[model samples]
Target: MPDRVNDTAAAYCRIWAERGVRAWEEEWWLLARDIGDRIGRLINAAPDTVTMQPNVTSAQAVILSCFDFTPPRDKVVMVDMEFPSMLYLYRRWLEGRGRVEVVTSDDGITVPLDKLLSAIDETTLLVPVSHVFFRSATILDAKAVIERAHEVGAMVVLDIFQSIGTVPVDVAALETDFAVGGCLKWLCGGPGACFMYVRPDLNRQLQPRLTGWLAHENPFAFERETLRFTTGAYRFLNGTPVIPAYYTCQPGLEIISEIGVPAIRERSVTMTSYLIAEAQKRGWSVFTPTDPAQRGGTVSLQLPEAATVCERLLAQDFLVDYRPEAGVRVSPHFYNTDNELSDLIAAIDDILADMN
Candidate 1:
């Protein structure tokens, strides 16, 4: 762990000490609101356009369930490479009513944006895509896809879990109708905290079907007859929030904001580039894009014995993850340095040579 990482964690500890558990009070929905606002600011979106959620899955469900889709126009488009959560949610939506048409990518690992655009007709109500392919770390042209979807009067929902803190995103500039991401992984926010972005103009248009007392305009009034939804993106929040998790996450978010997204993105790209170069040098097949512009923090390498390799790497104290389709996935955060990546590559080389 670097001094900077420790310092940032310490700062959060100080915040927790000063504010105590009372930091996340019912009256202080402003704390949640401020976090969302900061996220929007970091992503170059309007404060009113952002909302806090329990997780990305909850946010996606809220966005999907709210849309009024009729036959033919009831279709939602997604690529085969999407995370299982998104696919499962869309499948559940299709079970009784609407249809989910999955567009197959040329390579099963990457979604072809053109194919996705071609699949969207007027019948398409929403075009949902993962900003970065979880398994392969393949980056999507979210801005272009959003712009194209709007041309056909379709709403674009982006699952930005893999790219949220790893890559620089401008929700407003991208013109996406809805975007969902969590604090875990790159955000380094402990678990269970997520954020959603809903375009301000589209807030009223998209109603919340999974509403709870918290989302009600006047929860304390206890007016059952009159269920008034919130005026902004906050309406997406379904129930009481996890105070501890939110508090734990605040520090990580603050760290990213202060360090700056552009710098973080640059470091992520550089680290991944170095790892990819080293893997290629070792004659390993790389799954992630060679171009930094088309990649995120994760870099995948092809190895025949992925499970065995992953287990060995873990035993060796090198942190990495495994993806079924792409073999080993190495996701290095900005706090991680080139030396750490070099050490990981060296370990991989030794492991492979020993296997030979």
Candidate 2:
């Protein structure tokens, strides 16, 4: 966690106690606006093209709500390796409205880009895929996906929950329709701080049901008779904001902004490469891609009794997570040292050896 995060969050609480209701208008709301601006800068998006979300699920809900699922454009394309929450949401929501065609990953390790591209056709309306897959950590070529989707008149929604702070992503360069990510993981910010970026051009055309005062152009005018959303990304905003979480999130985003994503990606690739080699030598089944370009910050390992092993590792304060499909995932961030990883592997070696 960022050293300043606790201090920042505490300061936010103090503001609430002392200033009370005035803090919303006088101070807290300004921080809310800055969260959007910072997220816009994170993805190289132009100003006014980003907005805060309590989480990526909410951001996705808004994007999905905007679509009509009309005659020909009634297909939504995704992949088997997508985040489970999103995959489940799409399956439930798109059941009758549209068909969700999920392209299967040949090996659980990597998803073939060609397979995903082949799934996109004239009937497809939107393609929401991960920028860096949660399970395998395979990095998709979103630029290529965007180009292909545009040919068939489909919008692309890129989820960067596993990529934003660790990988280099420029929405302007990629020309993707939307990008969403949260600060919970690499950013060291706990939760309730996520963002979505809308292509400025698409903002005017979309009218999402998930909206509030922030979405209105003239909110103070009280013109409820005719509903009108703002021209740019502000239209994506909905309901009252989460203030304290943004305070905790601000420090992490600022730290990431200071260090930069390119630098972070370089460190991640180098560390993960070394870990992959070490894992292979130890006879562990590595699920993450060996190629740095196709990899993210995580190294997924398939070991016997992964869930039990993960529990043991957690007991020792070795922080890593287990996914049902991916086994135990060891992610080394820029803040982590090479020695720390070597120690982790050494411990894992001992623990697994004991198991046998």
Candidate 3:
């Protein structure tokens, strides 16, 4: 977590301890909507159409629960390059509900666009895919996927977990039916703060079985005769809001909102391009897309003994992560400088040299 975010978290911890029961009605209940509105601008969606969730997987669960998974539309199409968590959730949820058809990636980096489109047939009920691939940071063709899914009467659910804060996204332009993302990555909102976007029209239509009292039209009324869901994105939410997480998320969201994603994206593209160029110059394989248009904020360097190198980098207080096939991932955000990236590459070289 960023220091500013941590500071906000600490402030909230004090508020929770100091205010106690008085805070809930006064301000705690409003954080979800406040955060949702802030998140809406990031993705180019209306504020009311977005809702706060515990995580992306929870949001996915709510969307999945909305459908009956009946015949003629019992198929869910997705890409192999999507985050494993989404796949895991869908596979387990659909085991008894429906079936999942994953479009395989030819090189374990980018998804085959043609194959992905072909797999979304008339029988397909949902097409869930990542806006930017988790491992390689490859930006998917969201508009094309949405178009194909619509042609077959299938709804497209985009997981923008990797792209929302760093890459430019217009959910309205893409005509995506649904979108889910978290503040954990580029948003810098830290863990436990995630959001889901439902189209205004779709918001009125979905009745999520994975829901709780908070989603009720009159939650405090405690009426159990007939469950009346609240209109708008609130219907997607389940259980009490994670207040502390919401509090911590504000600093990051405020920072990103002020700088604007377009500016951040430009910085990200430049820095990641530099990272890719530097890695490639050393005869290392770059797993992320070479084209800035096809990439997000991250550049994955396919290094020899990458796992060991990543361990050493962490030991040196260099924060980077390693994935099995993607190797060492270096994500440079708007706050990062070109010199830091260069120094990081140098550090990698030093680590590799020591190993040899």
Candidate 4:
């Protein structure tokens, strides 16, 4: 997490101690919507079209609950490289309602666009794919996927978790039906704060069944009759909003908004390319794409005993992660320095030599 987040958290505590319940009416009520506006600015979306949710999974579930699973439009399409949570949600939730069709990755690194496109036909209802694959950091061809899905009358639910802060995403330009992501990774906003962007037109047409009192038009009225969903993206909210999470997230969002994603992307590309070239020079395999445009801020370098190496690196103050298929995932963000990347590679070499 970024240093500025500490300040935000402290501020949250101050507000909690000082105002207590009264703060909900004075300062806290508009927080979720305000955060939505910040996210909308980042993704080139209209502020009214975005809303803050607890996490990507719940945001996706809300989107999934909106439609009935029957007739020709009953198949949901996704790629194998997608984050496993969505796949799990679709497979379990739509057991009898619909079927999920996952397009497999050819080499366990990236999905073939043609194979995925073919899977989406008139029978397809929703296509939930990642903007950048979580494990490989390989960016998908979002435009082509959106076009193909729309062509076949299928709605697209884009998971932008791996790409949002480091990658430039124009939701307005993509014309996707829904986009979901969290502040945990690239956004540096920490956890428990995710967002969903519904295309304004679609937001008007769909009503989610998996909803709570917060989505009600008159939540304070406490009428015990049929629920009336609030207009715009608040309709996706369930129960009470996570107010503290929003407080912790705002500083990171503000920092990214000030730096601008395009500048961050440029810095990321330079650092990741350097890291990949350094790894390749030592005869290690790179799981992420070599093409700068086809990748995000991370580079997955395969090495001997990758999990152990990751543990060693973290012990030495190098913050990197490892996955089952992707080894030694090193992500270079805007705040990272070029020398730090070089030093990390050097440390890995030292660790491996010692292990040998």
Question: Which structure among the candidates has the greatest lDDT?
Answer: 4
Which digits, one per residue and each the tens of the lDDT, describe model 4 over residues 171-277?
99999999999999888887889999999998877899889888888889987888988888788887788898998898899889999999999999999999988
RMSD of each: 2.8, 1.3, 1.2, 0.8
Q: List the residue pairs that clash in candidate 2.
A: none
lDDT of each: 0.81, 0.88, 0.90, 0.91
Ranked by TM-score, the better of candidates 3 and 4 is 4
Q: Tell me the TM-score of each prediction against the true structure.
A: 0.92, 0.97, 0.97, 0.99
Tell me how candidate 3 scores on lDDT: 0.90
TM-score, structure 2 vs. true: 0.97
Residue-wise lDDT of candidate 1 within 1-356, one digit each (tens)? Answer: 22354654565577668877565463346656777887788778887677888888888888877866877588888898888888998888778778889999787667777788898888888988988889888889888888888988898988888888878888878888888888887777877778889888888666778778777887778887866887776677778776555566777787788888789898888888888888888789898889888888898888869878998999998888788878899999877877888889888888888888
Indicate the TM-score of model 3: 0.97
Off-target runs (Cα >4 Å) in candidate 1 are 1-28
* Count of clashes in candidate 2: 0
Question: Candidate 3: where are CA atoms >4 Å away?
Answer: none
- Tens-digit per-residue lDDT, 92-197, candidate 2: 8888778999999898777788988999999999999899989889899888899999999999999988998899889999999998999899887878998888
Structure candidate 3, residue pairs in collision: none
